[model samples]
Every structure is written in C-alpha cells, then in structure tokens.
Target: MVRTIRHRTMTTNSSKTPSSHATRQQNSNKLSRTKKACFGLMTTVLGLVAIELTLALLGVGRSNADGDPMMGFSKQVPLLERYVDEDGKAWMRTAENKLVWFNDQRFPLTKPANTQRIFCLGGSTTFGRPYDDNTSFAGWLREWLPHVDASSRYEVFNAGGVSYASYRVAAVMEELANHEPDLFIVYTGQNEFLERRTYADFFEQTKAQLWLTGLVSQTRTYAAIDSILRKNAPQESDADSIVLAAEVDERLNHTVGPSDYVRDDEWSDKVREHFKFNIRRMIHIARSANAKILFVVPASNEKDCSPFKPDSEDGSFETGQRSFDAGDFASARAAFQLAIDRDICPLRAPSNFAQFIRDLPESDDVRVLDFESELRNVCIDEHGHDILGEEYFLDHVHPTIDAHRQLSRWLISEMREAGWMAADSIALNELSAETVEGVDQSILGRIDRTAQGIAMRNLAKVMHWAGRFEVAAPRARDAIELLDGDAESQFILADCLRWTGQIDEAVVEFEKGVSAYPTYFRGVQRYGLLLLELGDNDAAREMFSIATLGWPETDPRHWAARFQLSIAHLGACDFESAHRELQECREHTPGDMDVVFAIAEASVGIGEPEKAIELYEQVLDEFPNDVDTHLNLAHTLLSTKQTDRAAGHFATALSLAPDNERAQAGMMVIDQLKQSAE
Candidate 1:
C-alpha cells in the first residue's frame, strides 16, 4: 500500500542560506542544554553512590555499627591468658597471644618511689626462666648488691620478655618510664638480628599491605573483593609454618649462600646501623625520663662462638663452618655459615658490638656491664664449647637460674666498682657471707674479730630449732647488732623476742626486717604470721594479702602467703574470705593436702556440707595417709550426721598415726555420740 511518500527537498539559494543557518543555530543551542542536563544528573548520581559505598566499606552504616564484625573475627581467634603449669608455675604470653616466657612472671611496668630502680631489659635470657625469681639475675643483683654495700637499697626490676628484639626492648623501656624508674639496663643484641625479620619488616609486610588497603577501600564491592582475596590466599599449614620458621632460623644463622647479597659488607653495615639506631632510641627514651642507662652485650656459651682452636688456623668464618659438621653436617654447616655471615657468632659479636656501642656519644652515660666477659669465663670449657653438664643453662644460649645467680654476683661487683651502691650496708655484708665462706678461715681468724654476734646468731638459730626461746633471745639480740640490721638476722632476732615474752619488741624487729627489704616476702610473711600469733587477725590478713600480691603468681611464697591469709580469715571467723583464700590456694597447689583440708574446713564453717564432703573425699582419696585430713573428715561427717562413716575414718586415722591427738579426740567424740544415739 505504497502511498508514495512525497519528500519536499528545499533548495537554498546563496542569499536565503543565511536565514536557514539562523534556524539551525537555535536547534543546536537546545541540544547543548539537553546534554549539559544529562551530564549534571549523572555526576550527582555518581557522587551520592560514592559517598554511600564509602560509608559501607568503612562499616559506618547503622547496621554495621551495631554489629562489630572485627570483634567477631577476633573472638574466633583464641585469646591466651596467663596460665600456671602442672608445677604451679606461670607462663607468659605475648601481646599477640603467643606463648613466650614459660614458668616466669610477665615483666612488671611499675617502679616504687624514692628508691633507685634498675629495670633489666632483654629477651628470655634476662627474663630468667626455669629459675626461681629470687635467683634471676635481677633477683641476684638485689641479693648481692647488699654484700657489696650492706646498706644499698637499690630495687632491681626485671622487665625482660621472650623473643624481644632491641626495638621491642626500647618500646618496653618507653612503656616502663611511666613508672619512674631511675636506671635502665639493657641486655640484648643476640635477638636483634636473630629473630625472624625485624619489627620494621613486620610493619611493612602487614601494616603497609593489609592495613592500608583496608583503609582505602570505598565500596562494599571492593571490600568484598579484598576479603575474598585474603581468605582464598593460601593458608599456612602447620607443617608449612614450621618449615618456614626453620627457614627463618637458617636465615638468622646466616646459612645463605655466598651468591646471596646478605653476607656483603653492606649487610653487616645495615645490621650495625639497626643496632645503633635502636640503642640511640633507647637512650633517648631513658634520658627523657631522667633515667640512667646501661647496655649489656649478652654473653653466650663457647659453642655459640666460633670454637677457640689456638693451633687450627681457621678464620672466624671457617671456625663457624666447622661447627656445621658436628650434627647433620649439612644442616649444621648451613647454620654455621649463616651465623658467620650475619655476625651471629655470639661470643665474638658481643665484644665487637660492645666496641661499636662504646664509641657512641650516648654511651657516655651508658655503662657496658661486660656480661660477655663474665659469661665466657663462667660458661666456656677448655675445648671452646659450652659446659652443659653443669645444668646452669637450659640450652646453648639461655642461662639457668644458677647461672643468673653467678651473673648477679658479677653484676653486683661491677655496680659497686661503679659507685652505684653504698659501701657499709648490711646487705653487702650478708651477701658477701657466701664469698667469705669460700675464703680461708685461717686468714679470717687472724683478724681480731669479736665472735659475739656471729656466735650468738648461730646459737640462736640452733636454740630456736630446739624450742629454747630463753637461750636464743639474748644471743639473737647480740647477733642482730653484729649483723647490723640484716633482714634475716632481724627475722631471727624477732623470732627470739617473740618466743621470750617480748611481744612488742619482736613486732618492732619483724617490721624492721620487712622495712629493710620489702621484696623479701619471707620476712613479710613471718611478720604476718607473728601478727596472727599475737591475735591481730585483721592486721595479719592484710599483711598476708600484701605479701601474696607483691610477688608473681607463680612464686611458691605467693601461694604460701595466700594459704596464710586463709588461716587468718579462719581465725577472724570470716568464712567467706577463708573460702576465697582456700580456693586461690587450691588453684595454685591442687595436690596440697593441707590446702584441701583447709578448703573443706572453710566449707564446713560456711555451712556448705556438700562442698565440704566433696573436699574431704578428695583429701582422703589423694592423701589417705594424712592424719589431719582424716581428723577433718571425721568432724565434717559428724557435723553431717554420718557418725558411722566418721567413726570408720577415725579408726583408719588411728591406724596410720596412733598418737594423732586430734584424730583420737575425734574418735572419742564419735564413740560417745554413737553411744548416746544407741
């Protein structure tokens, strides 16, 4: 149906074309306006979308704000709390929740006022694990300094952490400065270049990559993309983690091939620079806090250093290389080679590093403790290997508690020489007792020394053990005067006074003992026990609490103090407090029969027969031979109206220990009660 579309073609003449151009211009203006409007609308829509997406990605939306996704993820990861081991010792965890310091207290951050506080900063070596806290170098220093100067009242605080590098140590120093410490002692360097990648590397690998990307993402789509990528990325299997760790250890040991650039002079220079930088930062922080600083180049076993072969013409590198052949020679060789290349030769490196450190301007105020020299002399054998037979070290690097004691003695000597301590203090004399004991008695006897104090103190100890208070008192007093206010001497003196009806004087002496060395919990606990004996239950409980809280949780004395506090609570008729103390004591020493019995007694006092019965059963099952347990169980059963059971337990107790007065009394009562019932 082609109705032929007739098209009218307009032909413009040259004069008429101008008028046609004007009409076309109007149409073009209209098109331009429409395009501008479209562009404006698109730009506005995109801007709003961007704002919304940014809010979403940042988790700023109301729904996301209400629900913490990051917190949820964190919850899925286990949080490691401080835990006590089977041996009633505590283990420390890192900020990352990784187990670090085993069977030791986490380093404290605070220092007391008006006291000269020395903060020992280092790795596990300084932390002094597998040793009693009192035997740690810090503890040793505290114990020995008094020998150098009996009146020296310096408080040494060990702030060491496991796997801590120099940078971490510096951070710890900064954190600790808030506690107003007077001196900062640094014992680090081995871990500086030995631990897998430095803090700088960790920051680069994690913060720069994941943290920055997370910060910059705008849209949920981009955020999801990043998350998915992170999730899908290959997870490190346990075996892989272990292998990687081994590889890291190899790298730290300097096992890299010569072809690798790590062994170059530049690498050494960089390591030196890293150490210097950290040291400088540490100095700055200490200076800012008006604290004195000392740098200790860590000492290592002879095996840690290149073997000292006088005749074997071996370069340091060659000597290290030889160590590689001792074990799986290939692995050992790799380890030795890497160690040399990285300057990880523990013995040699400390000396070299010390020299470098000494040259620094900051070192003007910083004393070098010469730990390397001391350790080398003590730990090295004739064959240029570590003497592991002594049990003074746990491994090639870490010192045992006994070793820490030795180091502490050396440190005290150095400190005395440096004029950091007093010369005439009682502590110095007491600490020197051991050294003097090693001295020839003939040489000591040549001096016109009065034997009054020494003889009296010894006699008092013997008499006290024999329960002869009348004889011990005068001797203890003379000894206290001779010992010149030594805490142990004062404690003995107080015990004597307490036994001789001089209660007021005894309390004063006990207080003096505690005042002399607040860190000495034995004295404090004794004072508390004395208070309990004096019928000051409230005061005794307070003292016991203070003593227990003063030391680390793993300290045996800390548990003992808690047990004492429970006894105080019992004396004061505070059953709830007694129960709480018993619970804490039980937690620390689960197998302790005394603690179990105490808990049962506390439960009975609190009218919890069921709990008491359970605790009694536990004591009987585990400590069937314990007379006290049997006696307590009898009383608990009698209270619960189980007379027959009480009588049977009493009979067993009599069989185990026939002279047990409490058990006999309990049996008599049970028999009488049963007779009355019959």
Candidate 2:
C-alpha cells in the first residue's frame, strides 16, 4: 500500500510541475507586455508635454489673460497704440475701433520731467455719462490743478468707461499701470450688475473646483486647447461657465425696466465676491507698479430714485418714499437700504461695496476717501436734507456737474494729504464761481455747450427705464425747455407722459416732433396704438397717417402702419375704408393671418355675405380646429340662410371649445332654429 501511494504521489508531482512551469512562462510574458504598455504611456505623455511647452513658448494663447481662476474674468487691454509725435513726444489716443460706449480722450504716454500722472478710473460717473469726461470730477481736477499749483505740471487722464464694473476697472488699471502711472483715483461701485454673465457649471465655489481653476488658469497649454475647442464648439457653449466676454452688453440695452432680471441669490453672492476680489486685487497690482491708489466711497440718490425692481409685491419701495415724504428720515434710510439690498436689477451697487472699501487695510500706496459722507454733508448744509437726492445728483448715482466740482475738491484734499503730485490745500471758499474751473459754466461747458440739457434728457430716459414715470416726466419737460423742443427730447417727453397715463399730454408731445423728423413715426405709431386702446379712433387715424405719410412703401413700417390704420377705421365703423386698408396691408404682408382675418371681418361688416363666407371657408380649410373661425363661419352661414352648413359649423365650434360661451350660444341658436323648423 505504501509503495502504491508513493508511486501515485510521484506521478501527480511530475504532472503538476510541468503545469506550474507553463503557468510561470505565461506570467513572465504578461508582465513584459505590461511593462512595454507603461513605457509607451509615459513616453506619449512626455511627448505631449514637450509639444505643449513648445506651443506655450510661441505665445499660442496669452492675450487677455489675468490671474482669473476659472478664467471667468476677461481682461482686455485698451485699444490704444503708442505713437511718437514730430516734437519727440509719445502720446496715446483712443483707437478708432473703440466702441461707442468709451470716450475718445487722449493723454501723454511719455511722462515729462518732474510730472505726476493721475489716472481717474471708474464707470459712467467717472466717464461723465449723459455728457462726457469734461464734466466729470477728473475734468475738474485737470482744470483746477493747473490754476492752483503752477509750480509742477500735473497730468490727469480720464480712463473711465461707461458701465464699467470694478473688474473692468482693474483691467483698465492694468493697462494704465504700463504707462508709468503715479496715482490712481478709483470711484466705482455702481454698475456692478449692469452686464449679464453666467457661471452655472463648475461654480459652486468648491475647493476642488478652485484648485482646478487655479491650475488651468495659469497654463498656456490649457488655454490653447480651450481656444481650439471653442472654435469647434456648438453655438451654445459649455465654456461660458468659465469664460467672460470681452465686450459688455448692458442690461438696459435691449428692454425697459427690470424684466430681464430675477431674484438670484447665488448670482448676487458671486457678484459680491468678484467685486471685493477685483478691488482688493487692484491694491496688489498698484503696489507692484509702485503707484498709490485711492478708492472713493460711492454714493447714490437713494431717497430720490425708486428701486429698479422691488423685492416685495406690496410696494415696499413706494412705502419707503412715502415715509421720506412724511419726515421719517431714520425709517426712510433703512427702507431705502433694504430696497437697494433686495433690488432685482442692481444698476446701482449695494451698500456692501462701500463696506468692502472701508474694510480694506490702508497703507502708503492704498487709501480710502469718503465721498458719500462729503455728498451727504453738502446736501444737509445747503439743501437741508440728510439723504442725498436730485439736489446733489442728476439721476440714480451721477452727481450734477456742479456737485462734481465739490467732489474733485475733496479728492484734491485727499491727494494733498497723501503727498501726491503738486496738489495743494483747497478750501470750499476758494473754489467759488470765479475759480479757474468754475466759469460761467461747469468744467464741461468748454467741451459741449448743451451738456446740461443733454444730461437732463439722458436722466429722463433712464428714469423712464426704471419705471419712475413721474420723476421722468419733469426731467423730460426740463430737457424740452433747454433743448427748445428738439425731436429727441420731445420723443422722450412723450414717452414719459404716455407711461404716466397722461394721454392728452403725451399726444401733444408726440405731435410736436412727428412732422419735424420722419423717423419720429415710431413714437407716433406707439402713441397711435395707445389712442386706439383709449377708443380715440380719430386721433389714432391721424397718428397712423403721420406714421405712414411719405414713408417708403417697401418699408415694413408702411405695412404695419396701414394695418393699424385699418384697425382705427374698423373702430370708427368705416367698413369700406377698413377693407381698402386691409387689402393694401395684405399686398405688403401676403402670408399674414391677421390681415386675412381682418379682411374676412371687413367683408361681413360691408354686407358682402358671399365674399365673407368665401374668406371664412378659406380660413377654416387652413385651421380646421380654430373655434373662433368656425363660430364666425357659422354666423355668416346663418346670415346667408344656409341652416344645414350653419348647424355643422356650430357643432364643430362646440366640439373644439366646449366651455366657450360664444360657441355654446351659437350651438343653442342653431338648435333652436332646427327645432322651430321641425
């Protein structure tokens, strides 16, 4: 038994040994293949890295790049080219390609000996919107500094652009820094949410997202790949969540009021974070360039301007205005602040902007100016009001050109304290009417003579956009008086009056300008529609005539005006005229269903039953499920004594619209007719 067991064990061992050696050989081959695959992957990765590095060194994707994690902050250099004049002086002027939103101002690029350059940067206020930079605070400084300090030359450049948020201002600062800036005066905060932007994807402010953004934002290789992918990407881009457009399309550009805005808490938080981040980052940028920076606390016409979009449905902003009227200043301020905080369309920056600036640590290169307090003091001292309003401001946030002078004087005080440039001590008494900048007009009168009137007109226009018709109307009227009833001002006035429910007044304003400019017909057409709504057919007809008179027949407005005229004719019960106008409208818009329906209704009113029946049947053939068309055809058939056809049409109308009162009544009338015949 032992000999048999040993023989079996030796035979089993010999078979198992051959199988083990075969398995070992197979394992060795698999391991060698795995090593080759790993080597190939590492080689491919290293080769791709080398290619990326080579492309990066060649500057494949480096333009408009800031230290923007996620690359959502699009930084653009100004469209300025440096040139040397015949006098061996370098200068930089606004490029021709610069959009209409920016100013056409020029400044010296090469600094003269012992000269200090002061850059005034912000949004429309700094740009002096409604007029130009000549009326801005920087304009006051440019004129005032020359007269006050004749010892040293001071160069003040207006680098402000319209609707420029702080991030955009920082972009401008980056460009200005390259030209040897000595000091930068920033007076931003308003217009934070003026532009529309999105970061819905990869924007939860997560640690992992931030880390990836930081890594990707710094790499030229990533940007190059992104650019290639962007060119091949679909029209609806996924990269929008991590990229910002170079140009801004302001919220007020396409519509009226805050219709485009919504109550987005997350978006607001993002804006707040970006706002602070941009301003704080500017400090480092300025310090790196050995330039001093002063940030001014922005103020708004909180009491005068109603909220663009109220948070509450119960008129919280209106209630706040009523409180101010009732002499409750404390409650009024609180309400106004709340309105600003909860405003859906944040055209004006919130109070947190001021708080952020105040909280910033001050140093030799960084300082803060309290322009809000200065404006409040001015209002209380002269106007007997603690809250700033129209007395100090022209619109929501822009200070009047007169107020701009005082603001510049305060800036001079701040600059002098900081020992910047040749700024000397300036008193309120010294900046009188006879001062160098304070001539018969404000600082801007040297540029545009009609700037004040234009400012008032612009003010009225924006107020209308904000849905403050009452505030808009008076400013519009003032603009008319100053502009001598210019067509643009008259049109704006009419718009304001129409919104305020003053139909008669609006008509007068509209008519005053319609004959002068044919293009003013757009306003006339709108008012004519308004009159039609108010049942003033004669006035509407007159407006339609004005809208259509001498206009090109091929133009779309001619057909539209004719259609409106037909409606007015129908309103006056002029069936023949309505038919004629609708026929002409159909010639221009042959496929228009509205014109076809109108012609059918006009034929019925004209007592042409066969013609009306033919048109109604044509409409029924196209829209077989249309309950209104079936009801109209049934009524026409009943009028023509086609009882069977009328009954069928009524049945169809009833089926299509069971709950329709007209369809039910028509069906009942058809049943009654059939019962009477029986």
Candidate 3:
C-alpha cells in the first residue's frame, strides 16, 4: 500500500510542473512589453523637448506690444517699469512718461510705515484736461488730505491718464496693487470709447481648446511654433483685432470726428459691457491685493453741452434745442438725455455709467460714491437749475476748479464715513472762499480768465471738429471776448463761417488769425488751409512752414503740417518741393492714399511720366471708379504717349463723372491724340 501511494504523488507532481512553467512564461512576456512601451515614450518625450528648446532659442515666436496686455491678448505689455537708481534704490514709474498719457508719479520700491498711499485713477477728466492735476479732483485730494487725516502721511498719486478708458484704468490699477496701495479711488466712464480692443474668437473657443491654449501659451515652444505657422501661412497681416498701441488712440480726436462715427447700437452695447468688465476687473484686482477700492459715479454736462455729432435729419437733437429755446426745461432735459443716450460719439460719460456704479454689489472692501447726484444737487443749489454746465464743469465732463474742490471734500467725507480716515476734521470743510481765492494755489496759478478762455476755445474746437458749427461759432465768440488776441478762437470762428458758406466772412477771420501761434497752433494750421483754398500759395507755404518747424518729428501734427506744405507747394506748381514734402509725409503715414496721389501728381509735374503712371495705376487699382484718379492717370498716360491707355482712362472717368471738368478736358485731349495718330 505505501509503494502505490508514492507512485500516485510522483505523477501528480509531474503534471503540475508544465502548468507552472506556462504561467511563468506568460507573466515574463507581459513585463517585457511594458518595459518596451516605457522606453519608447521616454525617447519620444526627449526628442520633443529637444525640438522645443531649439525653436525657443531661435527667437521665432516673439511680438512687441505696448500698454497692459489683458483678456485674451497674446501680445505682452507692461504699464509700470521698475528701475534701480545709482544709489541702489529701486523706483517705480509709468513706462514712456513722455507720451503724456499718465501724470508724473514716483514711488519707492518699499512701502513706508504709517504711510497711506492713495492712487486716483481715471480718464482725461481725472488728468484735468484744459488744466492739469492741480485743478483736478486728484490734485485737490493731495492737498486736502492733510486736513482730513493726521495719523498717516498721505501720498496721493495722480494715476489719471489723458484719453484713458476704464479698461486702461483697470490695467493701471493692477500695477498699483504691486506698489502696496492702501486705497484705489477709481473715477472712470467718460473715455470708454476712446480706446477699444476686440478679442478675436475669444468666446467662440471651446472649453477644452481654451484650456489647451492657455497651457501651451505659457510655453516658449508653443509661441515659436505659432509664430512660424503665422509667418508661413497666407493670412491678412492686420487681421488680429487687439488694440496694441501704448497710448489711447481716441478715434474722434484722430479722424475728422463727424466722418468717423455713426450710430452702431451693437458697438455701443459692447462698450457698455466692457465698462462693466473693467469695473469688475478693478474690484477683483483690489481684493487680490487686499486694498480698499472706491468708485466715483461720474457726471456729464447733458443739458449744457450740445450733441457733438447730430443726425443728418431733424431728430431728437432738434427737438431738444427747440425745447430749450421754448423754456420747457423739463422736456429739454428729457430730450437732451435721449440725445446723449443715442449719441454716436459719446465723449461724455454715458447714463449707463451711473447705473453700473449703483448696481455693483457692495462688499466690505468695495465702496461706491454717487458723486453724479451729489454734483447735480450742488448745481441746483448754486445755479437754480439742476442742469450742470460752465457753473461746475469746464467742458462736457471736466469739473471746474470749485467743482474739483467740492469733489475733494466729498471724497474726504466718504473716507471718514467708510472709516478709512479716523477723524472728520472740520479744517478742510471750514475753508472760506477768502483763503483759497487769496492764495495762488497751484503751479499754473488760480483758474484765471485766460485759462477759462483757453478751455472755452478748446471746447469750441472740439465742437467745430464734430461739425457742430452753429454752436461752436457762439462758443468761439465767447472765447474771443475773454481771450482778446487769442487766434484759436478766431480760426474756429472762421472755420464756422467757412463751413456755413460765408466765404468773405471766413476770409476776414482767417486773415486775423494768421501768424497768431508762436509754435504749432491749430489756428495757424486752419489759416494755412484757408489760404490754400483761396490760391494764396506763398502765404499758405509760410503758414505751414511755421507750424512744422517747432514740433518734433514724433508729433503727428509735424507730419500733418508737412503734408499741408506739400499741397501748398503743389498749388504753386513747385513739383520738387511738393515731392520732398510728400515723401517726408509718406515716411510718417506710409499708407495714406492722399499722400500717394499727391506724390503721383508731383511726379507728373516733375517730368517723371513713367513714375507718375505707375503710381496712378496703383491708386486706380484700389479706387477704380475715382474720377480724379482716372482723369489724373489719363493725363499722365497722355504725357507718356500712351494714347490708347489714356483714352481708356478718360472714357472711364467720363462714365463715372460725366460733368467733371477735368475728366472732360482729359477726354478731349485723348480724342485729339487719337485723331493726330490717325
């Protein structure tokens, strides 16, 4: 029995041996595959990293932009720059201070103990246009802070920039947070339309794509690859919709204000949305830095300031004017409000600004001051009319000196109410008119009649630019009464007359305004233009020469003056000088078709028929139906003995403008040339 049991045990052991060997072999194969997969992945990753590093080192994907990069902007921009001085101390200042955007400000690298650093932010109203910071609310706050608070040494920074929109203010606020700001007093709204940026396909991006893009954007490798692809791909060069210029390009200010703007309700709605975004962004930035934020509800001179750009038809603007004329103040007010609400170019703070401020969900760190209503109440008390104007405002939105004082006092009161300032000191509040009026307060001196006159003329010029000739004429007259010898008012009034078809009256005014400005002046420029129109080429040449001489090449006015001078040269048939001036202007504004056309005309006059023909071809390609271009090209071709080509252009010009005198002349010349050939 023991021998039989041993044989069975030996057979069972032999059967299990083969099964164990098969299982072991299977497990070994699985482990080997895993090792191979891991090795392949590691090699691929190494190769990718090597390629990425190589592209990054080549500097393939880099772009230079100015101002603060925000909200889907790929371009890198910085507002504030940190610089170390010779004394081994770091200071912070606005980059490119000479741009005249931001008021001059200096802050140390480190925040001081027992120091309350206040930053006042906003648009041109905050920057104090027609005057400067001293007369602005920011300036008043700096001076008045000492009376209101004593515990902390107050350092009020005028962070207000000229033509700065709410977006720019928010961008600046972001930078101020890094400087250890105790408080940020934001006073924006008037300049929302001054600068704009469109985020190309920002909202259209899928969440996954956004996430992936955000991740890759952080890497130099991705930027390089994107740059390379963009360079290689056939695409529109200026297709991207981001506004990258460091300074605000106020559209109305740059272009013929009347021609550039039209009622685009969609764009207006977008602007309102952006205004809200900027306010929320500022709040977020303040909270992130643990800084206190206060928003000032901005006011507008609705009842006083006329609609800058009125509709062509007699519409709400006319109704408002009639209402005001009829002494129906209530109806006038309503109509005026409607006009501003429907305004195509809203340089003044829109009604939505006040609503936006009041709508912000107030938190412990956030504060809102309804200064708009406060200003109106003050207007009611002082002027017996609730409508604010020259009584408390310099222009549409810029507050007068006394209004700035009122703003400062109100801000102090708000500070005390918010418990930001410990004491409600009566010292600043009790300031009698004698103390302020008696002393020469700011560097520019107390708001004198000269300053007021300058501001008035400025207002008139803006009105004139906007094609509001009727209102601008009266304002210019008022400015002249105050300024006496001021040429700006004179020229603006002259322009009003000229535009109104009173040629003789305009000529008289233009003559009076000539040679008024010592340096560059709008009046002098306008006078030169009038001279050009009147065929006084020598006088026009002299006027433009003076205008361009003083300003640096960096100033747009310098190039503009040069352009005018070139036209003046053309008027005198001085082809060489005209060509030189146009060439210089071309250097400034390369794509200006007006300059190109003028250059072509000058080339023709200078006996370069072939060059003129080439330039005319370029212009005709872009503006095929342009009668002037066709006629000019025809004339140029005729000079080059290209009768067939000349006849073709002349025929086209006649078709486009049958009554065009120059086109008629060109056609007659072409017919004569063909007949001579026959």
Candidate 4:
C-alpha cells in the first residue's frame, strides 16, 4: 500500500563539533597512508620474485658449478650408452660416474620388438654385495627368464647402486623410462637411514615447505646455497675418517654418525610419511610411463646383528642381548624386534617399514612380492630359526650369494603369478642343466678370486663392526692371500694382526701397509698407533705427523688426527706439545673423557699434581667407575697429605677391582699412616 509517511527531524546540538570533524579527517589520512605502505611492500616483493625467476630461466645466476640449479651436483655426467666390449659381453655405465659398470651384463640401444625389459632397483642388497652381478637375483632372473619361455624373449637389468635408497631409485626409474622398460622391480627400505639428514631436517618440513623445496630443488640458486651451507658444516671425527674407506663409495657414505637412540616419534613419523610419499611418487611415475611395477618387502637379520644405535631408555636391546647370550634364539628374535622398532638409527628397515610396504598393494593396482616372509620361512627350514643370520646374510642386510639364488627362485614364482611369464612354456622343474650352465657362464660363474677376496674384505668389515674379531681375522688373511698385496687387504690384515695379539707381526704388516698405500691416511695412523704401543715414541710421532699432513682440514678425522698426535707427544715426553694438542682436541670434542684423562695424565707427568687432581676429579664425576682414574686420583690426594680422602678412593678402587695391586698398596699405606698418627 502506498501510504504517506511522515519524517521527524531530531537533530542534537552536540552533532556538529569542529573538533570531531578534524579527528575524522586525521583517521582518514592514517588509513590512506597504511594502504599505500601495504601496496608498496607488495609491489616490491612481486618485483623481486619476477627478477629472480627471469634470471633463473635465463641461466644468469647459477648457484652450482655446472650451471645447475642445485648445488654440489656435477654437470659432467657420463655417457650411459650400451656398448659391446672386446669379449662380446654387453656393458654400460650404471651411474654417470665411470666408477660403476653393469658388471658383465649389457643391453642394446633399443629394446627388441618381442622382448620384455625389466629393471631392478635398490641398494647393496640388490647390487649383490660379496657377490658379483651374475650372482645377484636380477642377474639370475635375467638368465632364468629365457628358460621360462623359449619362444618369448625377456631381459632383466640390474640397475641397483651401492647405497641407493628410494629417492635415488626414483631418479633412476625416471632415467630408465627413456630406455623402454616394460616392468620395474623395486626392493628397498633398508637404506633410508643411510642418508645423513638430521631429525629436524626431516620432520619440520610442512606440506607447503615441501612444495617450496620441490620448486627450489630445481634451481641452481638452491644448489649454490646448499653447497655453501655444507662447506661451513662441522668436521667429522678421526674414527669415522679411519673407517670410511670400508664402504664402496665415500660420496654415498653417511657424513655424520646416526643420532643417539631415543623415542624420536617426530622423526619416525616424518620418515614414514616421506617413505610412503616417495613410493607413491615412484609408482605414479612408473604407471605414467606405461610400465608395470613390483615392490619387494626387504628382509633383514634380526637375531644376529645388534641394533645400529640402541636406545638408552629402552631395555629391549639389553633383554635381546641377554637372550642371545643364553642361546634362546626364539625369545631373542622377539626382543631384538622391539629394539629394532625403537632404534633411532636402524640401517636395516624394521618390521614396521615392511608392514607399510605390505599395505601398499591393497590401495594401488601393483604387484606385491613378499620376499621378506619367504626369506624368513626358508631360513626357518634351513637354520631352525625364524630370523636369518650369517648363513644367509653377508651382514645385517646383504644376502649371501646362495641367498640371492634362493631369492631369484622365489621372485620367479611371483612373476609367474603376476602373468609376466608364460604359464605353458616351462615349469620350475623343467629348467635344464644346459640352461643353468649357460646362465652360469654368462653371469653367475665368473667371479674371480680377486673379486671374491674384495667381497670377503667388505664382509669382514661387518663382522669386525659386530665384534666378531676372530671370525673376521681369517677372512682378512684370506683376502690378503687372494688379492696378493692389494692395499685395502694389506691394511685389513694388519688390523686383524693387531686384534689377534700378533703385535710384532702387526708392526711389520703396518709398515708394509703404510708403504703400499702412501696416500691412504688410515694405514699411516694405524702404523703410528702400533709404534706407540711398542714404545717407539719417535717413530710413532713421525708416522702420526705424516698421517695428519695431507688430509682435508674439514674432515671429521682432523680432530682424531690431533688426538693421536697428542698421544704421540705424550709418549715422547714432549709435555708442552702434548698439552697443546690436548687443548686442540678439547676444543673439537669437549665432552670426550679420553681427552680429559689425557690432559690430566700430562699434568701429572709435568709435576702439576694440583692441576692433575682437579682434572681427575672432573672426570670422576662423569665416570665414577673408572678404576685407573680412581687410582690416579688417590695417589694425588695422598701426595698432598689428604689421607682420609685418599683412603676412601683407594677403598673404592679395591671394591671395584679386588685384584688392583696399586689400590692394595695404597690401602696398606693408609693403614700405616693412621697407626703412626695414633
């Protein structure tokens, strides 16, 4: 209804003040200034981003030496083309670096029209350590594939690297996609912990952060920044430096020691997530490239090898050790599993990682090869234990040559189930002796004594790490004999000699070892330590100095070099030099009780009893059970006429070790002093 409305004007007298109008004007000006500042800042940021992107695309501001966006990467990649060698055997460079070859197998430039090419990817286990390529499962599979179907052609490529984890494998898969692989077999999970990333570097990355990282990882600027960052990173210890060569490639070696075992739930969560992501990405890539994929859940030696880094808070490791000592293998296996799950630094993948792998095939349209379970079952039948040990595994992760053969048998069945092989052509029973011989001739049977010895030496190192020195010594001796003066074998033999109490023989071997590998610092350092043990202080000092001279200052072993030098100086009675070296060691490793004790020993040698006492007391606070430290402290206290304190320490030492002669003598002296005073 269009009704007439009446408007009432009610204007207040207070509504139109000059002061209020001026305040309103001031507020409007402030808002305008804020908006202008915001706009200017946004414009500046956008301009900078545009400039950076432009420069990046133009290759103007490269961060890496190769004009690559990522730092520390070399642009000089090796030609990875297949070529027939003089022996008519096919070979190719597996990596861009000339260091690695495809062992004795080769492929053509293009896949044959009727042939199915399968590429296997993983770490040393897949690479077949302690065994040549012919003995690897992939190598065996290559030979076995032809026997499955005489009319159909099949080819298998062992694309495994020494320490390649999944991330590295993903890159490899991408490269091989161009080579026309019809199928891909991935057996990994153990080597994720092999990379030297910190917990924070892993878990703290958000999805957005990961997206940014993915974008940045493609740029030379990021590469340049990474190189700069690593250049300024802290040095490694002497122990790591001395033992680093035991690995196949130092470039792939872990740069830092694994973190001390802790719950580390955050790190575990991130690693699990990262592993899943990498696997999914790999699967997606393979599928996109029109290749069928098979994932093998890896097996490890749980009952044999101890946890790489045991947790301090968890008692499972101790329980497992006790069970192992008691010879209760079944119980030991369960306890060991607990330790492996809790371990912060597990070089071998725990059962949980395998569980993740087992769960993968359910959600995705891929083939699942449960090699882990089959391996365990075979091990149980052969060894009467659910978990495998040295009989099957070369170490904690690597399988024996025989184990690889067994694995190849199991994988063949899986392939058949996945319909990769012909059902009617040949059964497992039909694999003829002639086919076996040919397989042996082409791939499996060609590992020479020299190669075997090298593999043995690598294997002996794992034994040495596990404290089976007696077992390792014989293998080291065999390596030396077989290799006939190979520098690595000689050095290993010298170490074995020392461990086995052949001191004079070890000294001779050490001298020969250092001479054999003049540039290798480990032999030189070991030679010096051997000489020091034999009381040849002057020779030891010279040897230690030589060991320190040419090594990179940034190497962790630089501090270790200084530590050995200090010991040499102390042995030579060069108190001042020893003190200086100890000071340097302290700066590098402040928490090292060995360095602290060494400093105290030098103080005592120089007749600074008060300083010696102070240092000893500091050490005792941290390690009260140290018998030698207790004896030293007691003597110092007695020298200063602190009889009661000295007596207490003497008694404590005797309680710790009843056969301590020095402690016994000190106690007798204390009794005499008390009797005389009374």
| TM-score for each model | 0.36, 0.76, 0.61, 0.62
**Candidate 1: segments with Cα more than 4 A from true spot:** 1-99, 102-114, 129-134, 146-152, 195-268, 304-351, 358-365, 375-394, 400-402, 423-678
In order, candidate lDDTs are 0.61, 0.79, 0.76, 0.73
Better structure of 3 and 4 per lDDT: 3
Q: Least accurate stretch of 10 residues (summed lDDT) in model 4?
A: 65-74
For candidate 4, lDDT tens digit of each residue in 367-412?
A: 7788878887887788676656667776678887777877887888
How many residue pairs clash per model? 16, 0, 0, 7
lDDT of 1 by residue, 231-342 (tens): 8977644332212131113232353221122224544555566676678777777777887787776655333333211222335435444553453344543444344334
- After the best TM-score superposition of candidate 3, give how far the Cα of residue 673 lies from its true spot, in angstroms: 34
Off by over 4 Å in 2: 1-66, 72-77, 147-151, 200-241, 251-258, 309-314, 418-447, 451-468, 514-520, 591-593, 608-678
Candidate 2 per-residue lDDT, tens place, 1-678, comes to 999999999898987675777889989999999999999999988987897789877867643334544334443546567777899988897766664656777778768887878888998899887677777888888877765566777888887888888877887788778788889999889978988776555456776777666565556677777788868977664645655667666777777678888899998888888888789767866876789999999988787777787776646567678888998877777788778777888877788888888778887788898888888787778866677777777778888878888888788777777776454545445655677535425444576436667878888877876787766777887787777666666777787788778888887877676767556777778778878988989989988988887369988888889899999999988999999999988887887877887899899999998888888777777788988888988899999999899989888888888899988998889889889989
lDDT of candidate 2 at residue 576, scale 0 to 100: 96
Could you arrange the candidates by TM-score from highest to lowest? 2, 4, 3, 1
TM-score for candidate 1: 0.36
Residue 339 displacement in candidate 4 (angstroms)? 3.1
